[model samples]
Target chain A: MIVAEQKPFAEIAGFVADCNKILVAGCLGCVAVCLAGGEKETEILAAALRMHRRLQGKPLETVTYTATRQCDPEYVDAMADLVKDVDAVVSLACGVGVQYIAERYPDKWVVPALNTRFAGGSVAQGVWEERCGLCGECILHKTGGICPIIRCSKSLLNGPCGGSQYGKCEISKDVPCAWQLIYDRMKALGRLEWLLEYQPPKDWSKSRDGGPRKAVREDATI
Target chain B: MNLTTESRLEKLLKRGEFVVTAEIGPPQHASAHEIVHHARLLKGYVDATNITDCQTAVVRLSSFAAAVHILREGLEPIMQMTCRDRNRIAMQSDLLGAYSLGIRNLLCLTGDHQSFGNHPTAKNVHDLDSIQLINMVKRMRDDRVFACGEPIKEHEPRFFIGAAANPFADPFEFRVVRLEKKINAGAQFIQTQCIFDLERFSRFMEMVVERGLHERAYILAGLTPIKSIGAARYMQKNVPGMIVPEELVQRLRKAKDDGKNVADEGVDICVEFINKVRKIKGVAGVHIMAIAWEEIVPTIVQKAGLYPRPKAD
Candidate 1:
């Protein structure tokens, strides 16, 4: 899932300061699950924006709407009516949702209210950790399901680079060394021999390095 | 002395001579004066000097460029390369460039994380790990091909490859195995992290001897002379993969209480470490890393009876 966190209230307030009225948009996708940009958050942001503006000399109005999934065109198009009277649209979804809303409403001023963090899932209550690099290829079968691409600080294919001390990464004690985890997992599974083999340099061209990527489903396309 | 030896360190180690190497941290500012000064100070006392590649991830004069400065001082340089800053393309390009500039030895490392550096928010490019980097360099030399296996139509970079080891790092049982892994990946020599816990380092060397890894590649013990009690305490609390024993710290404190220079005591401790590790089987040499205090290296080398470095033509 695409994780994100809301922008500071003051920053959001400044974005719509000149506008008399604005639309606060939310998504029911990854941001909602992460407790960031959901329906409840949208209302809280809208009320705060109005109060912040009212405290100043000028007053502001807000209309809030939460889409099923803001990345989809159909869900974004549903906000056409709510966006018509507003001067600006404040998207509380990931970057994708802000772009989708902007693409749907060509002339409307759309600004992101949240910063898209990474593609990860909630680890515990109110906590999330990244799990993938989206590197276009997966080698979990060889590494005991541990992904060094995103987990290892150096993204080392052959690692536990002398920096692995006490199962923690050299960067921080809080961050567990990914190669250590892989070593333990492989050792437990009697696959330690697999780690002895060298892994070649990754073909980054398969990743974003090749440019904006696309996955076509020719059979399912309309 | 092997007057015609191109790689003094490699030749000395092969001839079973106890060699010595020192590290020179390039200046953060754009100047080669520090490098040249240290090279001059360490010329006749050490076999070769290692030019660090942004040690601790802080930005500094590049190791390759510093290698050139060291060569100008009539000293051989073991140019260090890290995977943190470059991908294979840039690494190979620098390898060729370093060799073209008369740099002979190469030390490949998976550098310290960027978060520890001055540029904390910088993006890192670990496109290759140390093991793979060693293998790539070996192929580029032995097979006369690039990392992609394409034949090198021109002169190839034939570096005497070296890798780093941390005997004090966790999963202590696996440290020796990883050393063997590095040797299998074509590392001609191994320089370990600084050793303050002699007992633990001795045990790590015992395992290496049992497996006969010492026969495959030369092993060099790393030593660092502590400047003061404060620096010792800082390394104990902050530096990763480092073990600064309390006993050594107390010795420095005792020196301060006796009204003696703490730095002289630091050099004494370093010289003592060299003598102890020298007796251990399979320990080929010592690599002193007297950071910011390269002038003390000559004293330590002389006290340890490793002075009058072998001449190589």
Candidate 2:
């Protein structure tokens, strides 16, 4: 899921301060699942904006709309009529959805109402934890399903560093040593020998180092 | 001022009867008008009214203003205060303001994080958590002084402070322990999150009673009727720590199949839930949250057989 945290109220207020006609768009995808950009959140943002506008004597003309998935072109097309009349669209979706709205309607201004955080899941009821780094690599099978890229402080591909003490990271007492976890998992699986296997450095060109990555399949394309 | 708020709460506590309370959501667009309307509708029917302060990370009319309006309408208002948006200084100032305005009851909470609220960019000032706020209130009441050691000649405002607990959210074993901590911090009452599992609540109560907390604190179970299958789904998915049991879903399904009024069915479900809750040992009361449907609260109270009581004095 594309996880995003809403920006502070004053920052959001300032972003759309110039627009008299505002469309507070919500995305019912990742942001909705995470309780960031959803129908309820959209209503909340609209109400707050209205109250702030009223307090400031601006008297904004605000309307709310939520697309099924703001990141997808098919779902974003649903907002064509809604976005046409509004002077600016304040998107409550993740960064992708905000950019999607901007791309879909080049004539109208699109502003992000949320600060996209990380791809994570709920660790507890209300607490979300970062899980994946989206570093354009998959090493879970070799690392016992734990992503070293995100969980590890150093993202070491080989083994536990000298700084690992008592299965804890050198950076903080709270963080469990990711390499230690990987070793323990490997030991449990009777594959401790895999840790000794030599692995080369990760290819940086395949990751964010490459400018604006894209994927296409000629056979799948309509 | 006819029915003293403390005496009324005390009467309910002493009787050990099933007390009923309702929520009053202030209008986002307008102020005193909606507050008074709901207050008048729910007056005398509910034991108290909870004036929510910007519930669900959304800004609304001030809870202080709504509480004052409820007071003028001859009803007790449980003023809901959050530690978000306000620093310790402003929180203390508001507490004093509410006290000076004759508002007595309080429900202290560590509000929704700024990330959850409408304005994401809003800087959250969580100077104190709910427990600390409760302790602060207790200190003000007992010592007649603020945390900064400012003294006043007059007695501090006597508030029946309450806090919230979610059994479904936290570990079951820790629920009672958390309650004990809140009670230790001087929480006179507790209004829990929405409870779908009465059996879980019963077990929680058993633990609470075993820990000897039943003697000191009044625990109120929260109940909000499900209007539709969609609403039920929404609550289960979005509301943090809220659990709507399978039985409730089945009841909603049955209501849908029977072609009965779904909204009325919702009230009937609430009535049934309240009846069951009232029978449970150590259960002090129930707080009904009829969000945006405050008018039906009186009907629910009447249906649940909690109406036509003498004015609490």
Candidate 3:
């Protein structure tokens, strides 16, 4: 899932300082699951913005709406009536959702209230850790189900690099060395010999190095 | 793998001489004065000098340019190349450029993370790891082909490839295996991380000797003389992949408390490490990384009886 964090209240307030009325939008997808931009979060943001404006010797109006999925055009089109009266739309969704809202109401000002971080799942209750590099190619079978592409600080193929100490990366003690994890996993699985084989240079053309990527599904298009 | 062209350090190591190499950190400014000064200081006392490449990811004069500066002073330079800043294309280009500029020895390394440097927000380009970088250089040199395996047609850069190892780092049992992997990837020599814990380094050498890895490539023990009690404490508590034993710190503290010169004690400790490691079987040479304290390298080399450096044929 794409994890995101809500922007600070002051920054969000500053974005709509020129506007007298605005709509606070939220999403029910990844952002909501990460407890960042759910329906409850949207109402709370809207109320807070209104109160903050009222205390500044000026009054402001705010309407709130939560989309089932802000990335889709249809869910964003549902907010057509709510956006007609507002000066700008403050989207609490990820970057994708902010663009969707902007595209739907091309005339109205649109701004993102959350910063989309990484494609990761919730590791603990409120903490999320990245697990994928989106490299467009997977080598999990060879690495004992550990992903070194995103986990290793150097993203080394035949790691751990000399900087791996005490099972942690040289960057920080908190970050576990990905190669250490791979080594332990491969050892447990009796696949230590697999690690001995040389891993050649990766063809990064399949990754972001190839430019913005897309997925095509002809079967589902119809 | 035996296709070397022009590296004095490589020749000395090949001749089984206990070579002594020291590092020269290029100035953060563009001045070449420090490189020349350090080169002159180390000329007769050491085999060759290593020009660090923006060590710790702090921006500085490039190692290639620094090597050229040192080479001008009649000293051979083991030019260090890190994988943190450049992609495969840029790295290959630099390899060709360095060779064309009369640079020979090349040390491949995975550079320190950018967060440790002044430019913390800079995006790192680890397109190739140190192992991959070594292999790429080998292909270009031994195979007479570029990293893409296309013909170089003429003048393929033949570098005396080197790589770094950290025996003190964890998954400690696997450090030796990693060294072997580096050797397999065509690293002609291995310069390990700084050693403060001689016991652990000795054990690491035992494993290297048992695997007979020492026979395949030259292994240089890395040494850094502690400058002061503060430096000792910093390396013990802060430096990554470093193991500074408590006894060494206590010795420095004892020296300071007794109103003795801490710097001299640091040099003594470094010379002691050099003497001990030289006695261990399969130890090829020593690479001293006295970062900002390049002056003490001459003293350490002299005190360790490694002076009057061998003239490589």
Q: Considering every candidate listed, which one attains the maximal lDDT?
A: 3
lDDT of 3 at B279: 95
Question: Native contacts retained by model 1, as a fraction?
Answer: 0.73
Error of 3 at B53 (Å): 0.7
> How well is each residue in B2-61 modelled by candidate 2, as lDDT tens digits?
222353665666666568888988888765888888888887888889999998668898
DockQ of each: 0.73, 0.02, 0.76
Q: For model 3 chain B, give the 10-residue run with minimal summed lDDT.
A: B1-10
Model 1 bad stretches (over 4 Å): B1-5
Candidate 3: where are CA atoms >4 Å away?
Answer: B1-3
The per-prediction tally of clashing pairs is 1, 8, 0
Cα lDDT of model 3 by residue, A1-222, tens digit: 999999999999999998999999999999999999999999999999999999996788999999999999999989999999999999999999999998888899999999898888988899999988989889888899999999988789987877778889988899999999999998899888898788899989899999999999999997
In model 1 chain A, which range of ten residues has the least summed lDDT?
A: A156-165
**TM-score list, all predictions:** 0.97, 0.59, 0.97
Model with the higher lDDT, candidate 2 or 3: 3
Per-residue lDDT over A142-206 for candidate 1, one digit per residue giving the tens place of the 0 to 100 score: 89999999999888887688878889999999999898899899999998888878788888888
